[model samples]
Target: MATSVKSLSNKESKLIMAHMYVAFTALFVGATCGLLQTLERSGKFTLPAGIGYYQILTVHGVVLGLVLTTFFILGFMLAAQSKTTGGLNKTERTVAWIGFWLMLVGTLAAATMILLNEATVLFTFYAPLQAHVVFYLGLALVIVGTWFEGFVMFKRHARFRKENPGERTPLLSYMAVITMLMWQIASIGVAVTVLFQMVPWALGWVETIDVLLSRTLFWYFGHPLVYFWLLPAYMMWYAIMPKIIGGKIFSDSLARFTFILLLLFSIPVGFHHQLTEPGIDPFWKFIQVILTMVVVIPSMMTAFSMFATFEARGRELGAKGLFGWLKKMPWKDARFLAPFIGMLFFIPGGAGGIINASNQMNQVVHNTIWVTGHFHLTVASAVMLTFFGITYWLVPSITGRTFTKTMNKLGILQTILWTVGMLIMSTAMHWQGLLGGPRRSAYSEYVGNADTAAWGSYQIAQAVGGSILFLGMIVMIIIFVNLAFFAPKGKEEFPIAVVSNKAALPPKVFENWKLWIGVTLALILFAYTIPLIDIIQSAPPGAKGFKFW
Candidate 1:
């Protein structure tokens, strides 16, 4: 899309608007799925035990995890890349509309297939239950829609770089390119499945395929896909965390490196998902585990650095005592309230995630609610929370409307409910998992084992907990809907353009090769996983296997 260097481009506005609509839509679907799951567990909802619930779960995951994220990030990068963006011409505007509509159609079609029992495979496509041809075809188109963004962003950056030769690229643009690269690579597996594997199978040309091969390919893409979901949230954190907490970012250099680190480490670490799966082996597991653990290094550095930045700002603001900086912080504006609560939710989730990422501890928690809890802590608590907050912060620029101050406050309140509710729900599931209630089951019907009855109360607790989560989701959707269609247009205190009012930096750092090389080396270890799992799953009970990382 051609954008003038003088004003905000149509692509950016569309992306922002699309982001809002998709984000709200996802919240709506995910919340509904959550309600059903809760109802099923409560033994209260009178729904049939069939494809509808499973498909709801499936669509919820696909929509929230894949569909909504792609649109949001694509829009964000496109909008952010223009050095001088003017309003789009009709052709460019039409492209934006096509991309958005393609994504929507794909999401809806995929949802329909999953709902109708045509695709019984879990959202992860854990293995074998194939969906209708339309499902994979629809999904392929969604990915294609996003690829259009790559074309637009690259051209825009090229134009900007040409005009400003020898200037370092902005960190935001650098991350955006890497995200595109990562997404392209990540999409290969899914693309192959759709175009080569699943599509043919659904067409009845192929009789069967390798389940292990397909599942392994899925994880290779799947785990990295989570980071794809996370990068935008991370960008927000690195960019906004300090501003919200009353500090400057500890180091722009560190944020740049962290983005690079994400690219380097995230792609190769997918094998860690296969540590217990049949497709991968022990050596690969060891290698993957090492990389997976190493990933924490940069991540921890980020946490420490962000905290230091907070302290620096706090001291400058005349705050005193160990945690007194938090006291002086503004607690009312949704922009501020959302992230504070998001960070509050992250500490425990990060801790639990460490357990899942561990080599040995994973055996205890794998395929159980512990794994579920760990992710809920990350996704529900951290990623989704930040997304919601940022949307609140960005709403005015995109919609030209201000949400009700009370509803905005209520949104903050919903975050509170979700925080407490997820804590209770996930903790209950974690405890139940230790008792061995299997994951991915329609219901946790533990038979006759002492551990089964032991977890009953915990399962019941989740019913209550999930109900609270659903309520929170309802409140959130209401808030977003009101803002989108009903909120009065107000003078935006900080328009989207003003959001990045800091002095312009050159855009040369984007071409840095060091970051690319580092990521490549770190990911090499992923190759070892499949061999490792095959060896270990066969070992007798109480046996340990050797490995090479």
Candidate 2:
């Protein structure tokens, strides 16, 4: 029966292939737009206001970051976890395909309108400055498509639990589930916007929707969505690479804890995004501030747990010194080591991240390059680097083909170039932000007496940094494209693979929702407690005339 199931699984590889095709296009579009944005900012390429540069930017962020990636992750998780967490069958597969097509159509519809300049919401789609109704409708369809994929994941998890009643989940499968749960809970913001605002507006039902209310709604979805992009990247760090390096996980339970923490704390921390917005009460700010701090707990724990894992693994492998793990860790093992280095960068990134997510600090730095630096530190460092590594690392497994060693090394080198360059770039960006540089503008054409010349200096640095980032990205392109065209064909077997798709034990019906529920409760407790206190103290909106010791 297991062999038959295994044989049937080969049929599903096409789904992953389809997803890869879509993903590559999305990545291409996304990267291209990013390059354009960089060029426009440089003393290089400038787009006239009437030229719809912001339109392209919207398509870029939405297509690459949201649509393409969302569908790709959905497809990847659907296949990767199906057999491992519990095997999904043909019906679920069909559902996923339906989801994919819906999203594709939605993307095309929205992209067309955006290009035509009918949809100018600029990715965040802040309301009042309404986009074409089709834009909102298209977005709704995209989320609906995502919901299909989410539903399929739940169905598969259910089957796995029922069939395998007494075993623990495979690590990859476990993480997939955590991501799905996070998506389920975190998507409320966008979902609400579509239902209450976009749908009505699109159908000519409403004249104006409150932009702040919509932005808040999106944050409810948006902040956690950042983690959705991130967790998969981290999953690769925790699950796949260590095995390639011949190391045991330092702590599996802690990894689980990190996912749980992100699930609850991530979205609730969204109020920090609203620190600059109006109509929010002081109580809301206080609650957001506290949740922002609570967010640190899990990230810090992950830092400790992941570092401990690496150190233990390094030590066991005969690494030495106070931080010899840094030096002695296997840099040559492309799959194993690249992600380890990437995780090291996340430490400062996470700290800066917490500050960006803080009420007070974000007020000082929000909308500045500080904000840009924070995310570049994250997506460029964590998501893009790790995902590139995973492309090199996982493609062989997924394709059942042998990748060229030279190409693998090229990919690794690219990741390093990007990581190091981005570190410098984001650092400069963070500093400039501290110096009052604005972000998300076409250019710092207005420096407001803040050494506008320094803006020129930093822009030069960013230009250099952007070049480095592109070099790495080009290497990434070469490696993935090469693997797609030249990697050897035929199914490769997992070295010591499990025979079935069912995740071990605790079927969906019997599953414990309490763990995640408890996590949400804890997050709410930590997130809202201070806001509750603010209600009592009646703090003012400006945060003015208040000093903390």
Candidate 3:
């Protein structure tokens, strides 16, 4: 008898590839829109044939920020869970496919509206700036699809726990469950605003909408949406990065603890995003700001754990001095190098986040291009680069293809181009913001005002940087194509870190979903209940929708 290698079933592979295809398609289209936005913003190019600046901006933000991230994260979670928990059952697989199709249909509907220039509301889709009713309906469908996916994941994990009582849950699958739980809970805010508020108002069933309330509800989902993008990257960092670098996990219990902390802290801090808006009580804003700062502790814990993992592994290999271990890392491997660079970007990105969250400092940068630069550093660079790194091995593994050396070299070059481009673009945006450059507006001379005049050079620099980033994106798409179809037929490893023997086992409390969920709900209510009531009670009359596009 011949020994058999463990792998995802052919059915599972096809399901996973469906997601990959959609995600990469979104990447190409979104990146092209981004490049066009920068060129138009520079005042050097006009959007030909009535293609509006806000139109491309809307496509860029929605496609990349919402569509690509959601598809890739859910797909990656499914793959990880399947591998770690002995694969999804037939029902689970069927449910996953259903979810995928729903999301795809939703994406197509929304994209059609955008291309028709019927909805240029940007990614935030804030109120008083109404989109087509179909757009809101499409977005609702996307969220519903994600919920279905989350449901199956929860079911699969529950089945595994029942089948093998007393055994520790697999790390990747546990993390996936936690991520989906957070998603299920946090997404309710967006769904509520869309279903009840935006959809009704857009359909003209209501003459006016309460702008403040809609915005409040949105930021409720918006800030956590940041973490929704982040935790998956953290999963790769904590659970997968170690194996790529020839080491075991630093501490499984610590990883679980950090994730729990993220869950507890992520949802209630949206008020920090609303620091400038009036009507919310200052005391409540202050409270949320404190909570936001508290959330930083887990991030620092993650940073500490990463450093410890690297040091211990380096020491094991008999590296000499304090920094000698850095030399021991696999610098040439794109799988390791790409996400490692992402870690470096987060140092500045996280600092900028703290600045934005602070009640006092927020007054300095609020609504400025600095806010745009901050997220570009975060979601665009750190999270995006990490996702690309995951693709290096993941696409090949699912397709039963080898990650060849030529492709690896191309990936590293792509990472370098991305880093340089983002550095230039984000730096210029930050500096210009401090000089009072506005965000979300197209090129304007402001009647030759001196202040506006100062932003011109920076805009030019943005165009340059944006063009380079577009090139990098093309390179990434090429890598994706090779991995999916043309790479040699061989099995690539799905790297999952083993827990260190010296690490303590996680306490059962970590798995207590009810306890965590209860605390999360309490925090959200405590943070928002009073203020929400005040907003509703002492409200201005609602405003009618506007269509600037």
Q: TM-scores for all candidates? A: 0.86, 0.87, 0.96
lDDT of 3 by residue, 1-549 (tens): 322222588899888889999999999999999999889988999988999999999999999999999999999999999999999889999999999999999999999999999889999999778899999999999999999999989998998999999889999888888888888888898898898888888888787776887888888899988988998899999999999989999999999999999999999988999998998999999999999999899999999999888888898888879888899999999999999999999999999999999988889889888899999999999999999999999999888887899999999999999999999999988887776778787854432233555667789888899999999999999999999988888878999999999999999999999999999999999999999888877676554222211
Task: Order candidates by lDDT, high to low.
Answer: 3, 2, 1
Candidate with top lDDT is: 3
| Candidate 3 least-lDDT 10 residues | 540-549
Candidate 1 lDDT by residue in tens digits, 401-505 = 665687778877877888778878888878877777667665756643546555567777888888888888888877777766666765333222112324344
List the pairs of residues colliding in candidate 3. Answer: none
Q: Could you report the Cα RMSD, in angstroms, for every candidate shown? A: 6.1, 6.5, 3.0
Query: Which pairs clash inside model 2?
Result: 83-501, 85-503, 86-501, 86-502, 87-501, 161-507
Identify the runs in model 3 with alpha carbons over 4 angstroms from their true place.
Answer: 1-6, 444-454, 542-549
lDDT of 2 by residue, 72-176 (tens): 677557666864664668898889888888888888888888888988777787755577778877887888888888888777776776788766666567677
- Write down the lDDT that model 3 would get: 0.90
- TM-score ranking, high to low: 3, 2, 1
Q: Of the candidates numbered 1 and 3, which has the greater TM-score value?
A: 3
Best by TM-score: 3
